[model samples]
Target: MSIGAVLAQLRGDFPDVTISKIRFLEAEGLVQPGRTPSGYRQFAAADVERLRFVLAAQRDHYLPLKVIKEQLDAADSGAGPTAALPRPPRRLVPIDAPAENVGLPVADDFTVGKELRLTREELLEQAGIDAPALAELQQYGLVRPGPAGFFDPDAVLVARTVKAMTEFGIEPRHLRAFRAAADREVGLLEQIVTPVYRHRDPEAKSRADEVVRELAALSVTLHTLLVKAGIRGVAGC
Candidate 1:
């Protein structure tokens, strides 16, 4: 079956499942669907079953992707899909606390490329925000559609994060600072990269891409550390 057909089959059970979520799971190697010659996904019966198991484990058991993958591996190894799986304890962190085990930023984390093309409704659904909230985000210039009038995948992430922040009393209007900061960072990065990116050498584009990725990672790291330091000062930690 095509990916859309697989999505349709899963939607009755997993209403929150979007194409991006399925693509993310595939990227994580949970379901190894075959690809056609034109690079389209083709889900076999086994693939759909694997997705069912993964989604069920996540919804019913709150299993993380790592644990879910281990279970899938065990099943693939003839242990049966019904084999017992381990469950990790979930912990709640304070809102002001930095996340645990964030680790060091990596270039790949900031690599700006994706194939997602979501409609406005898909973005709202995936982001868990209502139409009014989306309009607010647009008003603040925090979220935007691409030239093709479809949202980039990152917009979903941005909208989701903004929604979560709203729980802390942060409004979309207040997020303008964030958008401005990001714009400034992008402008700075562009100034630094455009020269190398426009070089006459054959390898210029590749080298420029690598440089931008590394710089982007470093910029985020710097911003995170600064925020942590400021928070510590504010909280007298």
Candidate 2:
């Protein structure tokens, strides 16, 4: 089956799981599915069940992927992962309620920013940046105005980063690469969701929204981990 089919199958229980998360697990050698001749991922019934095991272990036991991968390896070698893999049932989220209450901060794109919309001056002050610097960041797409033509609350944090980077002589033009990378990441995620997103099914739309949120969170987690690892290596840790 396709990844979308697996996602729709598991989303009833694991609402926050995304295709990115599944692919991440696969990368970590937790669950390996086969590939088709056309390069599409093909998941078998066993693949889906193994994924359920991994996600359940993560959510219920808070087991790190390393340990889970070990369990999977053991299972593959004839030791069963069923020892600690509990298939606990979770109550389904109501269809009417928004699915994006993932505890992300206000500036995340998942939430509407109509409230606390900041003007240019307000954004500058909050971000601790001057008007000219703000214009530079805006010009390069490092930051953007909100849907209502005001700055979202997250703009202040973006400005803070920009201001600090400027002190290191990193100009807005130099930061344009970050914006470009972000756009590319967004495109990759959209490709995963667009098929399910455009479907007429309400559940499909909900799954698509949840997948985007989960993927965004996963991306941030990965970025933070890589940066921290780089810093550790630089410090000879």
Candidate 3:
């Protein structure tokens, strides 16, 4: 089928489909459209299906292009059916011998074992957070243990900070206010990052990261000014 006809059909499913977006996906190696002698792009039925899968995964899963690429690569490598989209590759590296000495592990260098579920004590040790502080953050609804008593990696990082704060005599109740403030900050960030969620372009992905970091810096600046103003207000100066 011609690219335009494929696009027209795709627009039924994705109303905002644009030529540039398709080109961007192609550039990301998500879809490979054949070209005619006249240089017109030709998209087969399989191409349309691949685009549908890519778009659906992006919209529903919030996966980035790099991750999606890895999934597609894995599928292409006989890991599974090419048409049956898989989740992002979980293996840290590929499963094969290296062609040359690259100072990296060959797939056989690593051992694959059954997923080990960590206990609460092991989790605390790995997360570098004590029990009490973890409970405090849980009370504040800032973080929670995931399935099987594990915590998300990001949550573990935050838990460590909460633990450190407790060592400095900061109570969990006091941290609850900070959690509320953080929610507001995150809401602002979501507003700015929403556009990045719409398409799967590498440039847009980079800009999204920059936008999130910039928003975080802006939030810190605004909060500092507000705190300073409040302090001066109390001092009657």
Among the numbered candidates, top TM-score falls to: 1
Worst 10 contiguous positions by lDDT, candidate 1 = 86-95
List runs of model 1 lying over 4 Å from the truth: 1-102
Q: 1-237, model 2: which lDDT tens digit per residue?
A: 999999988777776678888888889888788999999999998888889888876655545566677888888887764454456476334324354434332112453335678998899877887788888888999889977789777888888988888899988899888899889888988998899879997756755665676567666656665876799899999
Kindly report which residue pairs in candidate 2 clash with one another: none
Report the lDDT of model 2 for residue 77. 85
lDDT of each: 0.78, 0.75, 0.68
Tens digits of lDDT, candidate 1, 1-237: 998999988765654467887899999999999999999999998788788877766655535567779878877888855544333232222223444415647555665675789999899888988999889999999998888889988889999898889899999998889899999999999999999768887556655776787678778878988998899999999
RMSD (CA, angstroms), candidate 3: 17.3
Best candidate according to lDDT: 1
lDDT of 3 by residue, 1-91 (tens): 8877888776655544567779889988899989999998989888887887786665445455677778777887978566555333322
lDDT of 3 at 148: 64
RMSD of each: 14.3, 16.8, 17.3
**Cα-lDDT of candidate 1:** 0.78
Between candidates 1 and 2, which one is better according to lDDT? 1
